[model samples]
Target: MEVQLEQNEKKGKAFIDKDGKTLAEMTFSMAGTKQLIIDHTEVSDELRGMGAGRQLLQKIVDMAREESLKIIPLCPYAKSVFDKDDSIQDVLRQ
Candidate 1:
């Protein structure tokens, strides 16, 4: 299994496997000056528990960090993922 992260403009997505076989994905819109609102996060059931979600989130986080963007996880999955994670909390709204 392979995962890939791709982004365009102010939108970002994490795609797993080629041929559009997405295992987990996240969508977000930029809000200028290192700030963004995460709209959604989805992980295929079959891919769940395999760390795919974390991989996807990591990719998104890396992108955000590289672009110096803060994040507001509006999606439940995203929020929950971060709730227990301290590593990515620096990018979250305080």
Candidate 2:
């Protein structure tokens, strides 16, 4: 599977798939100047148990680190992942 990222100044998405079908996606919007609010995440049934959701979130986290931004995980899935991963705290909104 491949993950593709698309973003501008105000919003962004991480999408993953195989063979032209979407497997999962995570979306977020900018909050103020230095933060991002992760608002939604979805994994297709066909991709369940494949860690695609985690991959999407990781892509978002990687982008945040690269851009020197923090993340507020408003999406439950993202929140849970952030809560469990202490290593990502560097870019997590308090």
**TM per candidate:** 0.83, 0.93
Q: Per-residue lDDT of 36-75 in model 2, one digit per residue for the tens?
A: 9999999999888988888898888898899899999999
Q: What TM-score number comes out for model 2?
A: 0.93
Candidate 2 lDDT score at position 80: 96
Candidate 2 clashing pairs? none
Worst 10 residues of 2 by lDDT: 16-25
lDDT of 1: 0.78
lDDT of 1 by residue, 2-94 (tens): 657666677767767646566677777777767878888778888888887777778778877887778888988889989999989978877
Could you tell me which 10 consecutive residues in candidate 1 have the lowest summed lDDT? Answer: 14-23
